[model samples]
Target: MSETRTRVADHIKHSPGVHFNELVRALDLAPGQVQHHVRRLLSDETVRRAEFYGRTHYFPPEFDAWERGTLALVRRETARDILGHLLEHGDARPDDVADDIGVARSTLEWHLDHLVERDVVRKERDLHNRVTLVLTHPERTTRLLDDVSPSLPERFVDRFDRLLDHLVEG
Candidate 1:
């Protein structure tokens, strides 16, 4: 799998239903560039889109395995990274996470939502309208064995570095 495709898939797996602009920020690609790959992914049936309010969210298919195709190479590493972050931080809000990790807010939320849906992470909204996140129940035995693994730790690290670089570059 090409690194860009893998990165896009990983981004989708982490944060499903993400918009093109958010994807551009998360993966550090241009808007048109991200849209191009997203269009291909949609055509390939590797991704599906949904509408929430006025926004469209792109997510992996319900029974479609992420382990196949371009994503297989980095799934384990990604899961390890996500899991490590949850274990270390306990819980966090999506926006805070995006800021901390250097990915766009919507992008981080996509990942958080995916983690929640896949049983890798749990999510709850508070009275103040803040979404709290934590690792899912019956924690993953290992990153490799999940029926589906949305590796979070590696993503955390990768985006964190990117965030740092973004800061430095600016």
Candidate 2:
């Protein structure tokens, strides 16, 4: 592998679930340059890609489906905050989680939907029909959180993507 491809692979190895733009910004490389190197790395099987929640995330070849899915969701700040809040509090009502994370209810619901779909979170209703959110795999999610901390720019991109998704869906 070329030095550039190796560097790109190394970055993805350390920062699992990093998206293309994040890679460009973090490596301070031109977008086209990063794309070229990333393509080469992918062809060489030095990394793998996962598409979830409207983002194409790259991971090291060793990551399993669960890890890839978890890492992809946690790379977004809102989702990570929700997971952290749930882990800290065990289980919480939707309103409580929205309040604790300081996000609007709709935004909270958006992230919650992704989490629930990934099976990292579970939603249960009491007899009274109140919804409660629980972290289905707290220990695993916590461990993966250590590996997928998004930078400020990545967080901005994630929020922007969510906003676009909301507007389009509406």
Candidate 3:
């Protein structure tokens, strides 16, 4: 691989769940340049990708489907906060989780939809049908938690979502 291609590969290797725009920005490369290198990397199987919602996250070849999904969500600040809260506190009521995370219920629900769909989190119901959010793989999720740090754009997007939720709620 060329130096540029290697750099892209290394970035994706180190940052398992980095999305496209973030990758371009992080590497200080033009979008076209990044796209060309990424295409080469994908063709050679040096790295892999997962598309979650509207974003396409790149990963090294080692991460399985579950880890790919989990990492994709983990790259989002709100979703990461939710997972971190649950990881530290165990399963709890959805309302309590929203309150504890200081996010609107709708925001929490939005992140929860992705988390639950990814199987990184599960919602359990008691006999009364009350819901509790539980991590599907506590130990693994805890380890993967350190694998990603949300970038400025990623954080901004998540915060924007929260702001919109607040607007709608009010």
Candidate 4:
């Protein structure tokens, strides 16, 4: 493999769920250059791609479906914040998570849906049927969060979601 491809592979191996834009920024490579190398890497099976929540995240071949999904979701700041909050608080109500994370309830629900769907989070109901959010795999999620960092696009998406929530709520 070329030096650039090796660098890209090593990055994905270390980072696991890094998106394209994040890879470009972290490696300080041009977008087109990264895209080119990524394509070659994919063709060569040096890295695998997982698409979730409108972002294409690259991972090493060793990551399973659950790891890929969890890593991908945690790449979004709000989702990571939610996971971290749940990890710290044990189990929490939807409103509490939204308030603690400073995101609108709608935004939190959107992320929660993804998390729940992927089995990363579990949503239960109380006697009154009030919703409670809990991390289904807190330790694993926390460990993966250490390896998965948000990309620039993921950050922008999170900000845009918050902005939309503000505008809608207002």
lDDT (Cα, tens digit) per residue for candidate 3, span 28-59:
99999999999999998998988888889899
lDDT of 1: 0.58
lDDT tens digits, residues 1-170, model 1?
57798799888877654555567777889877788888888889888876533546677885233322112322334334455566667787665555555555544554555555555666778899777877554343234334334335545655675566556645
Give me candidate 2's TM-score against the actual structure: 0.85
Task: Output the number of the TM-score-best candidate.
Answer: 3
Model 3 / residue 3 / CA error / Å: 1.0
Candidate 2 segments whose C-alpha is farther than 4 A from its true place: 157-170
Model 4 lDDT tens row, 89-131:
9999999988988988888888998999999999899899999
Tens digits of lDDT, candidate 2, 1-170: 77877889889999998988889988989999998988878888888998986878899999999889989888788888888888888899999987777666778887788888889999999999999998888898999998878788768877886677557655
- Deviation in Å, model 1, residue 3 alpha carbon: 31
lDDT for 144 (candidate 3): 88
What value does the lDDT take at residue 21 in candidate 1?
Answer: 58
- Give the candidates in order of TM-score, highest first: 3, 4, 2, 1
Least accurate stretch of 10 residues (summed lDDT) in model 1? Answer: 65-74
Clashing residue pairs in candidate 2 are: none
Higher-TM-score candidate of 2 and 4: 4
